[model samples]
Target: MNTPNPDTPNRDPSDDDLDHTVRPHDPADASSAPQRRFDAEVIPLRPADDDAPVHKDEDARAADIDTSFEVQLDPEPGAGPEPVDDGIGYLLDDPDGDAYPVIPENLRTLGGVGEAIARHTRRFAHRIAFHAVRTPRYGVLALLWSVVGVWRLGNRQLAWWWVSEQDYLRSLAVASGDSREWYRLHREVKETRRVRGLILAGQAFGVLAALLVMVSVAPWWAWAAVAAVGVPWLAHLGRPEDHPIIVPAMTVPRFRLLNHDVVLRAYYAAGLGHPDKPNQQVTFETTMSRTKEGQGSQVKVVLPHGKGFDAAVNAKKELASGLDVAPSQVYLTHDPSSHRRHTLTVMDRDPLAIPAGKTPLLDCKPRNIWQPAPFGLDEHSRKVTLSLLWISILIGAQPRKGKTFAARLLALYAALDARVRISVVDGKNSPDWNKFAMVAYHFIRGTVPNRAGDPVRQLIDALAEIKRHIIDTNEFLSTLSPEECPEGKLTEELCRKYPKRLFIWMLVMEEFQNYFELPDQDDNKQVAELLSFILAVGPSSGVILLSSSQKPSGVGAGDVQRLFNRYRDNHAVRFALRCGNRNVSDAILGGDAYSEGFDASALPVGKPYLGVGYLYGATDHTPTVRTHLADHGDAEKILTAARQLRERAGTLTGYAAGQDTTTPDRDVLADVLAVFGSDPGLHWNELADRLAGQIGDRWADVTADAISAQCRDLGVPSVDVKRAGVTRKGCRKQAVQAAADTAAAS
Candidate 1:
């Protein structure tokens, strides 16, 4: 149970009553059931037969006469005008369209066609080799079965010619003492045997004739061919039905096309419709058809009048069960034309197994950070791209599910652009992020000190530097002319002109949740504040924040917890891979994604499913992406090239350049308490005078105003204190001691 973030001064007082995290209890009562998720609330279905509910018109609701069109408007509006109909009795605004494209979407691009060919080639070669390896065994089985087939065929012919079954029937009649039946059976058997004997003799003569022709006119190879064909036939006949001499090297599953009956039955079984009820059965507004690639079947389904897409989505698992397929194979994409309409695509096989192949970065070519980077492919084989500019990305998953790899991928993308300054911070101190140090300006690992200096202090320094840079960039942009900065934001041209000043900065934090729960309360809060501030205002300043967390919830208590949740939820884009449960998935992707039925926890389980997840808030379609794999070698190679690019561009600095980025001693907390002495409290002027007197040269420039602001940043509160019967603002020794202890513990 998480609470909403603390309100700012601008928040409405009345809005305080809206406690979204919990249910409203009766004023006179104390307890209430735990808050229910909106999706869990059962929606009442209007199963009665009724007319279709009218939908709101889009064009009517749109404000068409905006600034560009206001002066050139053809008409004005008080209430929206009625929709005009064409002469042929159709509303021109509404057009019938097919979701399927003319060309196979995956084949529209050269890469897609090449990938398809390569995939098929790989599959074909595998099948060929698989069968080739088992050829000798197959031949041995055929020869063994053929020898038995010869004796079996001869015995069957002999029995047919001798009328063996007729003799048995005659004996049975004789035992029953039926003379008439025995006489009839004997007459039929005698006649049948005579006819069968003549036919058998003719078949032998035919065989002899065929052999003589093969021995004379036919070549030796022709006889071999005949034997080859005849041997397999004999083997087939001798073998049991279950056992075959030859078997398929690969299994190809067959899928039935989705027609009206199949689609309707699935919906009815899922309780979305009633087949026997009048006007309550699910119907298809458009004809059923195969997907562009012919890999699956798709249909335009419309639920009963009262039921919308929600009903179908909520019952998606049930629908998959009813259709006898895995839930991952069933995709329900909402149709924008109608609330009742949604497209259902049922795959023939598990789609998660489809490989996204390696990353395009394998070529080690530089990519523009402004353009969307090639991330991976969706379940439908559509390419998914990630836009790194002006957006903060959050990656969350259970440990060992490729959470670190996902964040590393984005960092590697930004690194390719030489102008992007990179900072790599690995809280868990894993080797997965080690390669990133090649391109990072500031690289820090774990909480303890390393060759890179103290990790915790270095991280604080990196964040503070980024925070200051953001403010500087904003101030510079504010002073720019419209011609210099058209969108009133950082642009590629501007950054290029002044690379050092405007170049993009990317901060990669792996296992960031560990920082939030640091043993030191003040350090935890300081890190949270700096990160929260940077995340809220960094993007417009060309700052990119990429944070990965295995534990996104329950990191700390009170303000730290609230800030962590707020910061985690505020990311512009989130990619969750193999979350432990729906709650974890929701925590990563937000509840809106879960409501839309894209649960990361539902991702197929297997080694192949690793690094694959639900990518939401990045594009219009929420795609389950199989992220492009970048192994350790790949990361090293790509990042080495990135380091060279930065060197060539004269963009290398900070840790990469071995510069001394150490900040001066910032133990302001310890200094403040030293000045306080044994006083219960003091005015700002009194504290500053005592610090100057006692601390010597260190506090020579310290002033009442300077110490007042510094104390706030150090987490020490100032208060009105009385000294010699005069009251002014200052801090007490008790508060300073607690602050120092908290910082020391972390």
Candidate 2:
């Protein structure tokens, strides 16, 4: 086999030995359409360039797993060719590949099952309504067109009986001045017309007899069935050739079910191969098959020998054109097997356009923070989740594209898990994040006071606390023996055991750039430095930072800007929702994402596609997700449930409990109310113990009688509380809450 180096910039003349070889195409199989070829036999094999990057030594070439391109097999007829590559490959047995999964991918997870049901159900119901609304129109058109069909059918039969075509023939004979010939032609025409007219009358009589029987002796259903078939036939024939009686109820989804022929044709049309030139024809590295989720098709494609993967990547648009699908429907994933190899996936429909619907957490179930949070559905309708442990996330997009909503959705998931401590900070003073305060330990709206005091200073102090917490938590974990803490990491059990000391902190910053553009340059730099440090080290210590920004670029001057850039780029996971440009999308998802064919800017625009974006660095597959939506009303509901869970577990603390977190507080009513939570009442002893543990040093030495006395002085009443087996004197939760509210109102 002769090979030429595409990188060498020059061709070798010795490679043209078979230039005159002409492969023939059979004329009998010619098609009306010139571009689509369906030849059953393979094109005659030419010299196989196969695949060689700089003509590797025979030994290395022999190790390649794919050997489908063997050249002139059995060089001599029925004789084995001379051995190359040390002849070692002959003795080696290939390893068996892993078997395909027994169960389908979508049915493997409960979330996946739910997503599939919801997606298909919505689609089916929409189609039902679409056709139902247009039924009246269809009925009217059928009746009108059938009348036209009756007239047309009679006219066509009359034309046939009259033998109208031979009238021209009779005239021609008359014009030639042949009276005998004209008479003969006229007689022949009359004979043909007589036979045709008789046949036509018989057909008309048969139809009338059928109708008469259907209307008289036949069942009523039989007459209806005749009308059903007969009416459609008339409508189809009588309607204008350019128009149709029935219109499509919906725009049919584009793209075809993929097969080898379909994939090969796409590559060929994209200039990756030539149908006639066997040497230049693209070859498949793997069979094209349905993806695991059964929503799309995937195949490992190797461009013709000399071409590299970039050749296919650069011609992506042409490839989509060939497949006749939107460019967004084509996904290209690079394969590590070889540079010439890349996986091509073409979806049956544009996945990004499929809406994922509302968040499942709307049910308000208490979720486990240790597991991955349900984020959205992927291109395959598989649930895409985000694991917040040991990793942080960044959300980036233009305004009104659901950037804030995407970030808040994750925070809400964390909120539902009672063990997770949350801090909500909105730099732009947006009301969207205000409801999160119900579950947030530290809530800040803006630089100035809107909901919380001195938002910048409060956030700075919160960061400082988080940094201290990270150090303290790490030190505590180091002290535990391997038996107690085997992995030197936070666990769900441990977080439950010591909810106050080792917290699962989630810091949500919405439109965070405003913090770095504050009037005080020093404050801007300070905020930037603190957040950057937290983003770097907090995740490992159980603090997950979720920062969202509409303006990810052009924030501050000098070090502040540099620090901001570092903070923006360091997140382990990034979700970009409809960014303004490719640069912004790259900034959010990173530079490599666009190369792999994911650009948030290229996503379809419109309200329906809101919350749809590329979720990168979160999973191995960077899927374009339609993130679950939780509007303000839904957010309030979920967050209220989260707060209730925390109150029941005795984990509510800081601002959410009305504690003066910036300084020390000794407010007994607020403290007991925070510890009281969802219980109707708590015995003084239980309340005292819970307060001591949850509120830390402030209540460490407080006694049951002391708290009871404090509650009574604040105009709170005592009530009878049932215990394990006996009744005890306890303060009612409502009484403490009323006292706290009264004090605040005063």
Candidate 3:
């Protein structure tokens, strides 16, 4: 019924001819209806057997060169002048040697759950804004017409003035003379504005006219419209449908314009092209395949914020009807209000989405997704329980995944709890731990003892002392009186008066792998022994070991078995971040467990899964716990509190205390004096020999390194080692005899 306006010379893009060319659907079919989306027309599939070979190099791509020189070979013919075996191989091979398909550049995959949420939110906002405001198609036409009108008027005036100006004036004089001619000059402008205003006025008048017609014939039109609307509505209600209104809307385009506009906006923002064409629309819904149960299809749509809710619903119904999916499956939400701001409302088709007693996992409230069944708290209680019971947690993620933020949250949890004692050792010198320095009981920054000083050696030595303390404590407790048993004697009153075990002690090693690995089995075994001892008995002694690593390859699993003989029994937990290594998840959480549950690989930053060993009926259960690292205020409070407690104690206990608790037999002073009296460059072998009778060989390396590194860091020049021997100056006079002997020997 629409026609081009003669008054307007130019046509707006919206009024221009739409491309409706239909391509052959499926070649095999030779007869299928052509489908259109936005602007791109998709032909129906002909169902031809698509066994065609993909075009590629006939010869398989040449094999890649091995980086290792162990199997060097002569170069093949044309192998790039002997030194290179054809540069082509290097270009094709993956540098990391991973075989998985590379992520395509054009796909625009979401970075994480956070980015996913951000992405959907942005789309939602953009759609809402777009749907609320319409571009003026008529204004564009009006401007073009005005230009043509001016040109035509100018030509007419020019011709009249040249042909017979006086005669034309005479003719015009009969009807107001030159004034009439002058008025003609402004006629185009006046007429153009008049036409535009009429067009604008027509819209209101048309609405009023339509309403009047409806009222005048209300009895008749109402029945017919209801019949039309009801037919589609009943069909959709009766059967799963994608767009019941598709047939009706096609016939009633004018009435369905608002619905189409909203749908277009939603789909365009989502990158899901409008169903009518290929390009996306700001407000439209897209179709996903049906569920396994064949309940209905998964529908995604965005309803811009502040837009009429009814319009959005109508669009959703249209799309849902066409897809043959339930109306409830269609999601309607807001779009990104601006370029950066995003919003999303996802409706799900699964019945189990909202498990019993659990809150729906949605970014915004007022659940948009529909699940057949409702969930309760019982669905998530097991995980919630684990998070509360375990105080200090260690998290590891591949870079940029959210490990540090999660750690900070966990630290915050400890601070908020008030009873947990937490310490963090950031081995990588990352800036993450710097902000929480205040709340951490012990916040160690940079590599401990420096890279040159060898922090690994220092940590191993420290763990040795903690192990010794455990053994001694166990022995002492074993000999206690019946009334002095753990239940009666291991009280806070007893602990406050003593140095340790008043509260639970947790040592969080950010990258624990650094300490666990050693150059030789002996060193490795010693470190393992220390770790096993802690893991086995620390729980009883009020200590918990929480360590994090990128991968769990070199952690003390084998050692845990050998030493504790409790391989699976020890409660050492692990959490992997998007690891390709399936073995890790299987080893920690049982076989194929992560497959069904939350994928740790897909974990967003600031979120992590907690794996526990059969503690809360979790037979290798790995439950996700939101990691909340300690904030600045809480970190400060914890650190300040620890500092005050340590200040009152007036000493650094646990190995650094210099109490000689681990040494036996001879006085440790004799060994120090023996080293000091010798020549300046005493070789370690010779020093070990001198202290042989007093100190065992096992203790030699540990003791010498500990004493030497400590002294050098403290700036004490008591004993100096050189290539030749050892030297001593500013020696404590109390070691005179041993120093004189060393001086005489040198």
Candidate 4:
């Protein structure tokens, strides 16, 4: 309501005598110059009185205009200034909320209750026995500490009294402001002194009474009780909290309790969670202690949304660092129940620090080849078995890494099965497999040279023989009705029905790379092709090929390398021990397998970890395993046992059967004649059928044409004969006798 000042800046002009529209002064009009234009100002107009007189002069109206209006410029139009961000605080919330469950460290697994009880009892007994052995020393230390405690009792009590008196004097100083309170404190302090004297007198009297009882009326057994219980208790009270009087001989690793905070911290440290977001939402399901000889803890974790076990496994090193443990001491495995869940095992010590003991195959019940054979113990010290029925195994590692030993384990188990026939080719020609020759149906020591031919040629011939076995087995399988082989593959029922006819043939080729890179290109190519064929088709026909090599890739021979890759692909089960680098690990396991964390190159290289390796393609998760060690003595014992079992069952055949070693070069005429005994008059078709049934499956390709050509080469003549209802081309008794005589003379 007050009138505005014209001299003030930024002030609105008075409404009286205000013009609604004011234009700029025209340069042509001199009188317009004195009239100020207030175009920038917006003023309200007031209605004039009804009786007011009107003035027509423009100069008079313009002289009342105010000049306080000024134009205010605005900023240029463009992108607006970015908003000031006070960062989101919810993202930094603590991840250890009650929303997630807490898993204990002793109740994770649901099955194997019996095994768990047995393991716990063993550990408890061992710990008690270990501590009991040193009880005498601990007892002596306890007695010495008790005597020292009695000597220091008086000094300790006096020091305690002096400290208490000092505290009381400080309280008196605080209450010095009030004269009445100061006098009251003096009386209280005198009473405290009297009470302290009475407590010290009682302690002295108690000690005197105990000594008097021990020397006079108390029994000798009472003294023993005091020494056993009283001494140790007193010693414990005198010892410091952090530093115990007695130190344990072994250093036991302490596992961090599995709780929400520990798990979230681990997830964040492993880079699986972001600081700008809530810690990866995890559900701690349950936990279990390792039910084995080793000391460790197991935690089952259900990962956050959109996460998987592979991510957890890939961050294994980070997790171990977060938990303040070694990488070898932590193990991450997938949960069988859910894809989003995983089991995290943290060990107190490396399980591979000790060599694996002998297997229990000799003591347990006999296992058929159809069932998985126990190979070794996994990283968690759980039994690991492998199925050889429909799979081939390729073992690769550096020298002295237990490549031969692993292969021998497979062969030994196969020999124990009465229905399984083993063929061992020790390419190194070492005595490692010499004992196996006792039980192997077809055993060839490649270390020894063949006097009559090239060694490589002999090796090639041995492989060819295996290929022939595959063809024969296939033919025999074709003759069986669908009822016998429902899946058109070898079954255990069929194996038991005709144990001699349908055998599980296992071929163990040690140093197999040598055969594939032979100097003779022809032999190398032939051996490669035969081995590839056997690996591809042998499993279905009950044939297993276990091959070991020091080098897995980059062989000088192109054909050999190609064959190696082919075999590697077909070998569904593979084990790689302490390799030199990632390249060798990937080559043996598979591309990306090493990156996926199944790194054999990470295995420790020493006698204790000699048989340690990463076993892949055998289960859903890759596991570090220590294969059982079976020395020469163990091998001989196993072979002797297996041979005796085979002899009792009448299942031994081939070279193991003690047959003529010269049968490899004998003509078909002599073999057929041997089957004939006395009767030699038989048709060619009849001869072929008899050979097929007698020689198992190797002679399945013996047709009438093959028979007539071989008979003519052996100087055996064929004549027309009448049999049954028609005359057919057949051999006469006289002609067969002449051919046998000629073969012997040669």
The residue-by-residue lDDT of candidate 2 on 1-746, one tens digit each, is: 32222223466655533322222343333333233323232223233353423334544333331232223321222322344445654665433222567876766889879977999999889888987888999889988988999899888888888888888888888889999999898888889988988898888799899878777899878878888999999988788887777677568755586788888888998988897886897878788787766678888887777887767777888998988888878888777677778889888888877788889999999998888988898777777888888888889888899988889889999999888888888888878988877878888887876544567767766776776788889999899889988998988787777766777899998888899898766677667877887888899899998989888888898988999999999999999999888888888899888777677887878887889888889767788888888899999999999999999988888889887665344788877878877888889889989997999656654456656766777898877889786789888888888888899999
Q: How many backbone clashes does candidate 1 have?
A: 0
List runs of model 3 lying over 4 Å from the truth. Answer: 1-394, 412-423, 435-454, 479-502, 518-523, 554-569, 587-599, 602-622, 629-746
Query: Which candidate number has the best lDDT?
Result: 1
Worst 10 residues of 2 by lDDT: 65-74
- Among all windows of ten consecutive residues in candidate 1, which has the lowest summed lDDT? 64-73
lDDT of 1 at 553: 84
Q: How close is every model to the real structure, measured as TM-score?
A: 0.70, 0.64, 0.37, 0.65
Give every collision pair in model 4.
107-287, 108-287, 429-447
Reference-based lDDT, residue 290, model 4: 51
For model 1, the stretches where C-alpha displacement exceeds 4 angstroms are: 1-99, 144-243, 256-265, 276-280, 305-308, 336-341, 353-357, 448-452, 478-481, 554-562, 601-608, 648-650, 664-746
lDDT of 1 by residue, 43-108 (tens): 222122345332245342232211111111122223234234345754554343445577777788
lDDT per model, in order? 0.80, 0.79, 0.42, 0.71
Model 4 TM-score? 0.65
Superposed model 4: Cα runs more than 4 Å off: 1-133, 155-168, 171-183, 199-214, 239-251, 256-323, 330-356, 362-365, 447-454, 556-560, 592-596, 603-608, 656-663, 666-746
Candidate achieving higher TM-score, 1 or 4: 1
Count of steric clashes across candidates, in order: 0, 0, 86, 3
lDDT of 1: 0.80
Model 3 scores a C-alpha lDDT of: 0.42
lDDT accuracy of residue 228 in candidate 4: 73
lDDT per residue, candidate 4, 1-746, as tens digits?
Answer: 12233345765655443322323323354333343333334333322463555445644434433432432122112423323335665466553222322432234455465557888889888778877888887777777766766556656787665446556655766666666765666677667777877888898799899899888988989888877787777777555578566777457766655555776687778876654666556667874545344467767778877877778877888998887777787877666567677777778677887566897665524557878887898876767888888788989999998988888888888888877888777777889998876777666666345763455645555666777778878898899888877777777888788765677889888887777666555556666777898999888788898988888887745766788678766788899998998788888899868545577876777778888888898887787889987888888888888888788788777667875322255357667876665664778777778887887444644556556655766788777766676778878667877878876788
